[model samples]
Target: MIKYYYPDGSHCYRALHTAHAVFRNEAGALIARAEKPDGSALYEFEITGFELVVAGERCT
Candidate 1:
């Protein structure tokens, strides 16, 4: 699973699969692109102020 956390260690968002990529938009919003664990469809999440964690490990 994928998890996002705030700088203060609060939970931000969670998803089933790892993110394919993450980047900031022209508007400076943090975004994550990923597919659902079931492989149903792709999705994008706006996850500003959140750090990424894949499985049980933190992602740089």
Candidate 2:
């Protein structure tokens, strides 16, 4: 699982990592792509104020 948070340390989103990956969009928004491991897109999220956290480590 991946946890997304705001800059102020508030909870934003939690995404299941079952064959899924997260990345940025063209506009620099955080996106959760669950289609395939190759990063084929399915869902897009506007994460303007969110930061990526994985395994208790901050990724972005």
What RMSD does model 1 have?
Answer: 4.3
The lDDT values for all models are 0.63, 0.52
| Model 2 global lDDT (CA atoms, 0 to 1) | 0.52
Query: Which residue pairs collide in model 2, if any?
Result: none
Q: List the residue pairs that clash in candidate 1.
A: none
- Tens-digit lDDT track for model 1 on 1-60? 466644455665555545687778898877778777678887886664444454455653
Candidate 1 residue runs with Cα over 4 Å from true position? 6-17, 50-60
RMSD of each: 4.3, 5.9
Lowest-sum lDDT 10-residue window in model 1: 48-57
For candidate 2, what is the total of clashing residue pairs? Answer: 0
| Candidate that scores best on TM-score | 1
